[model samples]
Target: MDPRDWLARNTFHHSAFQDLRRLVAEKERQGLRLSLCIPTLNEEKTIGKEIMLLRAELVSRYPLFDEIAVIDSGSSDRTREVAAAFGADVYESADILPETGTRRGKGENLWKAIYQLAGDIIVYLDADIKNIRPHFAYGLVGPLIERPEVRYVKAFYDRPLAGAGGTRPSGGGRVTEILIRPLFSLFFPDLAALIQPLSGEYAVRRETLERLSFPIGYGVETAHLMDVYRAHGLEAFAQTDLDRRVHRNQSTGDLGRMAFGILQTFLSRLRPGGGAEALPELHAMLRQFQARDNAYELVEHHIVEEERPPMIDLPAYRQRRGLPP
Candidate 1:
């Protein structure tokens, strides 16, 4: 059967398993352990409420998760304090596994969380989600725990994007619909079924996660999908529709930067051997100032973005496929 048909048959919605009690019991019977991880950065406004609700309703009340941890990217605000106050095991990304020198990114926090928390399965939830609910965790984790074949479960939000006029009822960020999806379609078509390709919410098996190398930045999500798909194939992926996820609306400038980073990461994989069409030269230069004695020197760092080859184009892979290089 084609991969799309497989996804249509296997893909699920969060509402499909609303009975958390049953889901928890099913997991216990199978002896599956789960962990909840939230990677934060100056998310004080929403962090407290998220930690409290998830821990209180899911961890403390239903014992749905084995551990709930908040891995942070050194926030200037009281993000850590708020999360901790709400009973979350908060740890700075830099503090965990100090040997690996900390970096400021969501992936850095998540990567650190793997080393700090212990669980057979890990469910990552974004801290900025405002309409936070237990379903966010239970829904994403349910499929993986219930079905051993499902190694990775991605959460798809049902929110209507502003000005989209419901044409795109199931909305995702600009990068997701435009760049990520098209790239995946051209290369790893099987992965195109993931509705929210850039969604921060997801659940994955510990073994699968430990074996993969995280990009440690915006590339993390893209890297995860590509890496996991390579290792486990399309059958291992599942997307669940989680009703709206309310979060801070990013400014266009911020979104552009995000899209640029993701594009660089994706293209780096799709390049090499003249793979994919040549893209227009994109610029990413930053202006900075250097302090010298009592004076300051204005400087500019010209970030010349380039790309590398994807694994599919390697000479070894071509040889294995009996294709002429």
Candidate 2:
């Protein structure tokens, strides 16, 4: 069966499992050690609340997670301070492994977290989630903890758009449902089943996670969904509805830039004619002329691909362990 059919039959909403207490019990019975990871960049306003709520309800109250950590992309704001104040272990992506060199983006933080944190299951949540709640973490982690067959869980929600005037009750993420979804439907129909394929919240088994390569930028979530599906098929995935998420709105220009980066990453993977194709040489910084003291200043940045080799090619990989080379 196709992924949409699989999602229709197997996908679940957080509302379906509101009883977090039951979910906790099942986690213990399975001897699962859960961890919550939030990737942030200038999220001081919301990170504090997110950590407080999850730590109080999911950690202190129910003992659901073994650790709650915030992996940041060098936020100059009080994001790291605020998260630490709320009792979360906050670490800078650059500090995680100084040897590897740091890259700027959400994927960089997440990739480092996998190496820094220890847990049987890792639940990655976005730092800017305003309507933060315990379910945001538990809802996504619950499925993987309960079902051994389920390897990954993606989060989707009712998003309310924020504008200069106010907030829109309905439409949000114009680029997603309109552009990305149609693209997926045309080429990767099975992937289209992922309601919010770009959603920043998700959970995955440590085994599955260590095997996948992370794209350290806007393309992380998309790359994850595509990579995991290619390796494990539709049955290995699940999704949960996390209600509404309110956050700062992105301008058309910003969204356009994001879409462009995602497209480049997506097409690189989808292209068929490939035989040691030369990898694209990516540039990180752009020079723009600004009226600053009547002089133009040049900014420097290092943009790197940090490409993740396919897991199937690894001899130590679970899927390839016993197969003859």
Best-performing candidate as measured by lDDT: 1
Model 2, range 150-240, lDDT digits (tens) per residue?
8989888874223366555432267777777887787678888777888778898988887788777767777777778888888889988
User: What is the clash tally of candidate 1?
Assistant: 1
lDDT of 1 by residue, 1-325 (tens): 3777867866787777778889889889988889999999899999999999999899888888988999988899999999999999888888876755666677777776666777779999999899999889988998887788988899987743245454644546787888888888888888887788899999988777766666666677887887787777888888887878888888755665566667666776566543655876545664556689999897655433322223234454335435578
List runs of model 2 lying over 4 Å from the truth.
Answer: 159-172, 272-325
Q: What count of clashes does model 2 give?
A: 0
What are the models' TM-scores? 0.82, 0.81
Q: Can you tell me which runs of candidate 1 are displaced by over 4 Å?
A: 159-171, 271-325
Task: Look at candidate 2 and tell me the lDDT of residue 47.
Answer: 89
